[model samples]
Every structure is written in structure tokens, then in C-alpha cells.
Target: MSNTPSQSQLHNLAQDIKQWGAELGFDSIGICGVDLRAHEPLLQSWLDAGFHGQMEYMARHGLMRARPGELLPGTLRVISARINYMPEDARCATTLEDPTLGYISRYALGRDYHKVVRKKLKLLAERLQQALPELKLNYRPFVDSAPILERPLAEQAGLGWIGKHTLLLNQQQGSLFFIGELLIDLPLPMDAPANPECGKCTACIKACPTGAIVAPYQLDARRCISYLTIEHAGPIPPELRSAIGNRIYGCDDCQLICPWNRYAPVTQESDFSPRQQLLQPELLELFSWSESEFLKVTEGSPIRRIGFERWQRNLAVALGNAPYQPRIIEALEQRQAVSSELVKEHVDWALEQQKLKKDQEQVENRQKARLIRWIKKALPFHA
Candidate 1:
């Protein structure tokens, strides 16, 4: 085997990598050794619990996910990078509270992050190869596409600690960021793990509308709004529909409730800002989009991957939760006329809610009139 680089040289290379990462738009960068043995058992238990839902790929990768060297042979160190994604001008709390407007997760509001982050990681890898040609570099860049445990690797690299929500949270940056990794053959200096800062904080757990976070650090993807809207293909479950409120896409209630997010920095990247009227679009407006229009508007967006059917499915559930109105009723009828059996079922349910509201209003009006008559009779002088 060839001789290893000196300790000073390795340390210098590590410092150079951090600087290069910053220049390439990464908010932070750190190195981690490829030994995730301690994490393997927890991963297996999560899979065994069937918490991954329909995402069989999570279990398909098996132990390779925890073993970076096995996944990409000759990998000695994993370079983890984070990029803040909360756009400076993006809508947050106000958009979520509007029952008539659709609420999309902040990260997916702009261009698809997977493509952007992967491209940057690949460019960073190329720069490293050119800088150290004598070093036999074997690197593979990945974003969310692979089965890599990105959060654990990022935490191990001292990027941040895993918060109660199971998301990586930084002391200075909070949890509003995207993570990417570059597995390489170079043996670089590793950073020490950051101290956990989420002390006795149960805000994320209590805030989840779907109760997806069963406990601290444990998530049931089947009940997660993000998973239901983006991953699951069929009709959403009935019990969670009302709780879903007017969110036509992914949900962000947990993140919004986290106190640490007060310090979350807004992203300067314009590509991450909300696009195509997604920031505060009315539920009926999005529900009225034809399949062609959906494709056109979501061209480069991550939302396009769900296809029009699942998109309609999620919209149907949101419409069911919206306040009763004639326009909403009419929109549902129009959709029901040409909608699939699955969508028609949800439309039927929404119509029932409208009928109930109308009946309740009539009963309330009659009761108020009777109470006025009783008051007039009691006051003989006024009568």
C-alpha cells in the first residue's frame, strides 16, 4: 500500500476543504470517519417497526446504508455539507393559518433542492481532484437520492445535533437547512460532535397535526404530512384529513413551533424563493388546475414528481377541510364530474360537510328568532 499523508498535511487539506465548501455556497462542511456501527441497530429497529411505510428502498439497501465503505468501496471519510434553505422572502406562519390558501413546505417552494445540492457537491469533488491529482481520490456525491443516513453523518461530522424532531439542528443556523455528502477515499481529520441543545423541548411533538412524531427522534412516515402528500399514491386516510387543514402539499408545523427556529437564517439563494403563486394560493385556484397546467407550473419543482393524480388526491383532502362555501361546493362538483373514483369519494365527503353547515346555520337562525320573541313577551311595557 502507498504511504499516508503526514498529519500536518491532512489537517491543512481539511481546512482547505472547509474554505472551498464555503466558496461553493455550502453553509457548513465537516468530515466523518466511515464507522456507523452504533447507528445500524437503531436503523434496523426503525425498519422493523414498519415506520418507513411504502418506501421499501430504505430497507432494500440493508447494511450498506450504514457502511459508507461498502456502499462506495475504498471510502475512508465522508464530507458532509449543509445549505440553509429558508428563503429570506418566503411566507411562513401567515400562509399556514389561512384556511383558503395552500401551504407547501418551505424547502420545496422553489427549485428542487436535490438537483441543486447534488450539482454543487459534484463541482466541489472535481475541484478537490484537480487540487490533489497525486492522491487516488474516489468520491461519490449524494443528496436525498441515496439511502445514506445523511442526518447521522452530518451530526457525527459536528455539523449539528439531531433535534427531537429527528432533524439536524445547528446552534447558530437552527434546523432550516438541507444536507448533502461526498464520500471520498481520503483520510481527513474529523470534527467532534456538537453538544445537544434541545433540552426538554417537546414543541415539535405537540405541534405535529398528524402526530407523526410518535416520540422524540421517532417518526412514523405513514402519518407524516410530507410523506402522505409527496410519497403515498392513494387517497389520504379519513381521520387525518381534517387535521391536515388546508395544506395541499407538505406540512411544516413542527418546524414552525420549534423555538430554536427563531435564530434560523434566511437563505440568500433566489432559486429557493416561492414560485408560480405557491406562496399563498387559494385552495380552489390550485384545485382548478388541469393536468396540463399542473405539469406546466411544476416543471422544475419537486412537487411535479407526485404527478397530477396524487396532487389531486392531496388537494381533495384540503378542500374537504376548507370552510363551507358555495364556490368550494361548486368546484368540488365540477371536479367530481370527471374525477377518478378515488377523487370522487373525497368530493362526496366534502359535499356532506357543506350540507351539515347549511343545516346548522338554518337551525341557529330559527333559535335566535324564537329567543327575541321570548324577550319581547317578558317586557310587557315594550310589547
Candidate 2:
């Protein structure tokens, strides 16, 4: 326990690490050497094209996002782990099919994964240090907190291939999971990256509501609903509002359409379970939440970080996209009176949208009535 371990010992330690990770609730774990030079250009090109949108942190780090060694000096390997997060009560289809219901992404339905994943990885690191006292066990745990390219790291660690949607996809478990990494100073047995299997299928790209997946393995975060709803702090772009549908938080349309996700397993961790308040919530019900109520309802959930203003802003867009309902219009008008300037702008847009929907419906109804009368007159009596 006191002496530096040999290669055989390191391999044994790697096995123990995966065992510990599984015990700590990670669905799967893999280890790989940290050499991301191949992934740098792709990351650079995405940044150069401004595909990351308002997530300035992604560019601020420069290439440090690709180089794991830069984040933790002496980091020789990335211990990648994925925790299944598809909650048992996930009603993705039901929520997505109804425009009247505000669909929060399934991942955000549970407690904030940043806290849960980071805590678990930290514990796993402590166990590694305790088990190998002589091996300078310098390590850092990262949930989505670091600038690291976690998906590629996970892919390199034999976790899964990055699907067209840009999410890591396991052949067995699909993409309904959270990825975390521990940068460690160990020569652990390396795991080979999973083979790409998407072959000719463009389901994710075709299914994107906003065409965010500009190409295979490429994404434009500017058009991504997840980025629009969570990362961007300003007004939601008017062009993309209706396409946003009733997705008030994040969009799962890409994943929902991916073929692999049909086999995704429900998470075992109860922390990843949905809160009754988050799932299948009505657009009007959420639009009416006072800032205090928003905070209280979203406490301990990932949705809280977006704050009440974005919460209202997103809900306003969804309300506008909903069927022409009088209550939705009234709620938008009432909130406009007291909302922040930002929220008021979205409310105005929503009000305009509701009016348009109403106008269109009235015209269509009149046309239908006329068509029915003409059909009756032209058909029955003499013919």
C-alpha cells in the first residue's frame, strides 16, 4: 500500500475504480490516455464559426478545452463515467406531443446534476487516493463544470460514440445519461473509443426543430433550443420562437428521435427522478409563477440557474406557440404589466403571436363554413 504500484497493479486499480464508480451510482466507467490533439481542430472550427453562441466560456479557455493535461498538470488519464439519467417517470412523448404543456428537458427534471455528479466523482477520487497512497494521486473531478471536451473524452474512454446531435451515445444505453470525468495521474489500462455506428442515418439532424446540427458531428448552438433556453441571456430570437414549440426549457427532440434511445435504461438514482412540479406542467401555470414562486418551485433543480426572468421569458415563448387560448393571452398581458424589461419584450412578442393565431383560425373557420355550404348546394338536390 505504501510503495509505487506496478503496471499490473495499475490495471487492477483500474478495475477497482470502475467497480467503485458503479457502486457510487455511475452506470458505466472507462479509462483512457489524455491526448486530444485530434479533437482540437474540430473544437477550433466550431468556435471559429461562432457555433457555441453566447457560451463565451467555451472560447475563453482557447484550446485548454481540448487539452486535459492543461487543466490538471500530471494528468495522464481521464476516468470517464456516465450516469443514466432517464427518469423512470419520463413522459417525453406525451409532453412533447401536447403544445399546451410546457416540456422541460428530462435531464433537468431531477436535482441539478452538477451537484450530484460532482459529489460522486469526488468520492470516487478519494477512494482512489486512499487505495494508492504512494502513487501521487493528484486528481480533479469535473461534472459539466470544467471547460473540458467531456463528450470526446468520454468517447476516447470507450464510453460511446458522439452521435450527430453531439451527445455521447452508448450502443447499449443510448444517450440518456450524464458524463463526468476525473483527470488523474495514473497509467490506467486504456479503453478504446467506441466505433461510430450512425452510418447514413440523419435522424437527429432531420429531427432538429431549429437545424442546430449543421452537419455530422457539428452543431450550431445559436439555433439549439437547449442553448436558447438556458445559456443565452438575452431575448429569444423571434425567428426561432415558433419552432421552439412548447419546449420552455431544453429540447430533447433530437434524442427523442434517435434510434438508439429506444433501449435507454431508466436511471437507478432517485436523485435523478422527476419532481411532480417539473413534468408536464401547463404553459399558463408556469407563466404565472412569481419570482419567489419560481425559486421555491425550482429549488435544487437545474432549472433554477436560469433564474425567474429566463423562466418567464421561455414560458412566454411557449405560451405564444400554444393554441390560441384566451387565458394564455390574458396571462401574457397581465405579466407584461409587472415583468422586467426583458420579460416584457418576450411578452409583447407572445401577445402578437396569440393575436395572429386567433386571426388565422377565424379566417380558416369562415372559409370552411363557406366551403361546406357550397358543397351542399352543388351536390344534393338535383344531382
Candidate 3:
């Protein structure tokens, strides 16, 4: 082992790291010592509750997730970094209110964050390695790939506190950010934890259409729109479909309703800006895309990971909630005639919804026309 760097040198290094992180597009950087044992029981209990749904990997990771040293054989501190993902021009309120528009999670509307964050982290690690040849750094960068409890580590590093929605929230940046970590075998100065600021605020919990929050700071991933649209592989549960609205990718209801989000900084990174037709796409318009078109449009996007089948599946559910129209009926039938069994099932369900809606609209239009005729008859001159 090499001699420990002096306190002043370590402090200077921390400052340099922060500067480098900002230069590399990261909004904030903090160091956290490796001691997450306290979080193990909570993780285990959450898994035991089966809140993770079909994501068996969460349970399989066991205590390794909470113990970073064991997962990476790291000897010292972790460097946690965050990048704000909320697009500068994103219309959060309008998208939330207009259920007909597909509400993609803001984080996913742009380029895939995993690749972008990892690339920046790798560059940061390289810079550190070059700065001290004798430092003997054993560093590994991770985005959302590993079992690491990123939010808690970010909190311990003083990036932000874990909010009631279980997302890391900064006083200045709110919760519209993505977190990445660099586990290194070097001692670094750490920051004080940010104080929790979610007092008396139940907006996120109350706003959740599926009650996925379950309790404050606790999330049942099974009912979460983000989980269902992105992480889930099979057919979504029937009950949560209506609550999902037209979010074909992921949901941002909690963040939209959070009072703290008013302070969330919009990202300046061009890579995080909305691409293709993601920002204001109509449900039927997206449903009209062929599989090839879907692949082409979603190229280099995080949405591609879900594959065309699941993408169609999500859209089918959204179509069911859309106002019934002839085009919607045609779209469902077109997919049903040649789609996979899984996609076919969802299309069939959407067709049933469309039929019901058509019947209702017919009755409403007939009543409306009758009222118009009655008014005309009452005013003989207008007739």
C-alpha cells in the first residue's frame, strides 16, 4: 500500500474532482464512505414484501447491493455524481393534464442516459488516474447497471436527500436528475448530508394514480408506471392500465406533483433534449408506426431496449383509454390481424374499449342533435 496522501492534498483533490465533474456535465459531485449496512434490512424487507414484482434480480443481489465494498472490493470512499435530466423546454404541466398525449418520463425522452453518464464517469476516472500516478486507484464507474443503492449513497455523499417518493432531491435541482457513482480505492473528503425538505408534503403520494407510493419514502415498484413501462417484460397487470394513462414509456406524475420540483433546474445538455416525436406525440399517431418505423425512430434511445412488441403493447393499452374513433378501431384491427399473440391480446382488449366508446358517442351525439332540433323548433325564425 502507498503512503496516505496528506489532508490538504486530499482536500485539494476533492475540489479538483468537483471542478472536473462540472466540466464533464455532472451537476454535483460528493464523496461517501462505504458503510451501507444500515440499509440492508430495509432492502431485504422491501424485497420480501415482493414490491419489486418480476424483477427477481433485486432479491438475488442480496446484501451485496448495500455493501459496495463487497460488490467491488473497494478499499475506501465512493464518488457520487448527479446530472439534471429535465429538458429546458419540456412542458410538464401540459403533458400531465392532456392524457391524449404520450407522457414519456422526462429522463428517457432524450438520448439514453446510461451511455451518456457512463462516458462522463469514465473520463472523470481517467482524469483522476492521470492526476496521481502513485495514487494506485482501483476505480469502476456505474450508472443504473449495478446493485448499488445509488440514491442512499448520493444522500450519504450529500448530493441530496432521498425524498418521500424515494428519489434523490436537491434543494436547488429538485428530483429531476440521474445519479452515477465511481467506487474508488482512494480516501476523499466528504460533504455533510443535505437536510430533508419534504416535510408536510404528500403531493407525490396523493398524485400517484395507482397508489404506488404505498407509504412515504416507500414505493411498490409493481404498481409504478416507470416499472411497468420500462423494467417489466411481460404483459402489464390489467388493473393498472387505466391509471397509466397515455404514458407509453415511463411516468413522471410524482415529480410533476412534487412542490420541490418547481426549483428543479432544466438541463442545458443538448443530449438530454427530447428527440423524434417523443415530446408531444399523439397516441394514435404513435400506434400508426410500423415495427420498422418504431425501431428507426427509437434508434439510440432507451426506449428501444423494450423492443417493438412491448412498445406496441404499451401503445395498445393507451389506445384503449383514448377517445374512441374509426382510426383507432382500424389501428387495433390492423395490429390484431398480424401481431404476436401477446400484442394481439392487448389489441383485442382495445377493440372492446373502442366498441364501447363508439356506442357511448353515438348515444351522446344523438342526444345532442335532438337538443339542437328542439331549440330550433322553439325558435321558429331560426328554423
Candidate 4:
């Protein structure tokens, strides 16, 4: 347990890590040095511009997010790993088009990815430790659980490039995968960074519902639906509510529209499979759940962190955007009376939306009736 490994030993270890990652359900693994100082300026600019919104942890960490060595001392090489989380039959477009159905982000439809990806990364790290028992190996695993800038690290490690949507995109796997990191002290051969493949394609930028992607590689999280519904705890902005559509939780519009996603592999992991209850459930049915029911159903899932109040708040906005269904109106009304100021505000807004739709439908029906009467007078009954 006292000898240092040769350069050849380090190279072999990197290859073994990738193989171990695959056996642990990770789709891809790459290694890179932790000199993210080049990204510090951009990170500071993003924080200064308030693009992170209420996610103050982003700023609180400062440039340390880009410095892995600071997070875990003696870090030499970062082993970045990605696992496909896109389930079979995600029905991304179908669910989005159906206003009656609630659109939870594809990633959140199953068990929480934090635990799943981190568990596998830990195994990969353990395998490395076991491989070199005498080398005094030091390591730590992170799956979107720490302040480290994961996407940039993944891109630098050659796992993928940062797409226009600011998510990691691989030529083979696209962007429907979870990224994790294993910071290690061993000096491993680093992988070449992936070249940008996005070309002139602005599909992701155009596809963002809230225009959260203000520019290529720049995201204004304040306007993002995923941020509004999940990260932000206050009232949903009235201006952006209608744009949120039926997305009760996080969103996937950008990923759904990406051309490269045609090659996205369906996850083999059963843990990522969509639950029947959350896989495009009726807005009314989801809206009907009480606090206890919400907790029970979303237990062990990523959606549980948002709690029932935000759940109702999001559903209220979605139900408002739904077609003028009397039941939807009744549901919003029922919630509005007993809800807190936060939930009640959204419910009231939803009721107003329903009322407007009902009025518009009435106006259209009257116009149709008038047109029918005019046709009857102009031309005698032909039947």
C-alpha cells in the first residue's frame, strides 16, 4: 500500500474506470484535469446578472463552483460520468400538446436521479480504490448534489459539449442523461474535449417556452419554467403562467425539439421508468390529490422536494390554461377557498382564465347561431 503507480498504470486505471462505469449503468465516462479557472469569469458574470434567480447557492459558492480542488483538496483528475435517464415511451410531444394532461419533466417521472447516478458513481470510485489499494487513493462522488459546475466539467471531460440550452449534449446520447463527477487524486490521462456539434442549429433556443435561454449558452433562470415551478418558492409570475402550459413540474421542451435527440437511447434502468400515475396524468386527477396523497405518491421522487403547496400552485396555473372544462373550474374554485395566499393567488388567476375561455366560447357559439339563421333565410331548406 506504499508504491506510486507508473504512467502506464494510471492510463490503465482510467480505462478501467470507464469499464466499471458502464457495468454500473453509466453510458459514458471521461477524465479531465480540474483547471476551470477559464470559466470563473463567466460564472461571476452570470451571478452578477442575476440570471440564477432565487438560487442563491449559485452565487454563495462564488468561483469555488469552478474549482474542484477547493471542494476536495488534492484533486488531480475528475472522472465525469453520464447515465441515460430518458425512459421508454416518454411521449414528450404528445403530453405537451394535451393541455388536459400534466407534463412532469421526463427526468422526474421516476425515482430521483441524484441517488441513482451518485450510487453508481460511488461504485465506480470504489472500484478504482480497490484497484490500487496501495496507492492511498482519495475520492468523492457528486451527482448534481454539490456546488461544482457539472456540465462544464462533463464537457471538458469529453463526455459531451454544452449545448445551446446550457445542458450537456453528446453526439450519441444527446442531452437526456444525468451527469456525475468522481474527483480523484490519481493523475490519470485526460480525455480530449468534445468539439461543438450544435452548428447553426438554434432549435433549443427557439423551443424554450419561457425564453429562458436568452442567448446561446446563456440561461436566464428567472424566466425558466423549471425554475419557476421547482426552484422559485414565491408566486408564479402572472405574465409567464400561461406560457408554462401544462407543465406541473419541470419542463423538457428544448430537449424534445433537439435534432440529435433522435439518437437518444432509452434507459435500461428500471428505476428511471415513468410511474403510471405521473406519466401524463389528467390535470384534474393530479389537482385532486391532497397534501398527504401528494407526499405519498411523490415519495422517493424528485418532485417531492417541491411540497404540496407549490404542487397545487403549479397545477392551478396549468388547469387555468386548460380548455374551459367545468370540472377544472370547479376544482380551482374548491382549492381557492381553502388555500393559502400563495395557492389562492394562483387559483384565482386560474379561475379568471377559465372565465375568459368560457366567455370566448359563448361568443363563438352565438356567432355560429347567427350565421346559421342567415343561411336559412338566404337559401331555403334543401333537405
Give one digit per residue, the lDDT tens place, for model 1 in 1-383. Answer: 15567889889989989999999889999899988999999899999999999888988997678888877888899999999899877677778777888998989889999898998899999888877777667899999888788889999999999998888999999899999999998889999978899999999999999999999999999999999888887778888888888787898888888888899999866778889588888888999999999999998999999998888888777877777788988998888889888778888887787778777888999999998898889986775
lDDT of 4 by residue, 117-148 (tens): 88988888778888887767788999888999
- Cα lDDT, model 3, residue 27: 94
Task: Give the number of the best model, judged by lDDT.
Answer: 4
Cα lDDT computed for each candidate against the true fold: 0.87, 0.91, 0.89, 0.92
lDDT of 2 at 350: 91
Q: How many residue pairs clash in all the candidates, one count each?
A: 0, 0, 0, 1
Model 4 residue 259 CA deviation in Å: 0.9
Off by over 4 Å in 1: 1-4, 372-383
The regions of model 2 sitting more than 4 angstroms off are 371-383
Candidate 3, poorest ten consecutive residues by summed lDDT? 92-101
Model 3 gets an lDDT of 0.89
Give model 2 RMSD, 1 decimal.
Answer: 2.0
lDDT tens digits by residue: candidate 2, 232-309: 999988999989999999999999899999999999999988999889898888887788999998899999999998
Ranking by TM-score: 4, 3, 2, 1
lDDT of 1 at 227: 90
What is the alpha-carbon lDDT of model 1 when measured against the actual structure?
A: 0.87
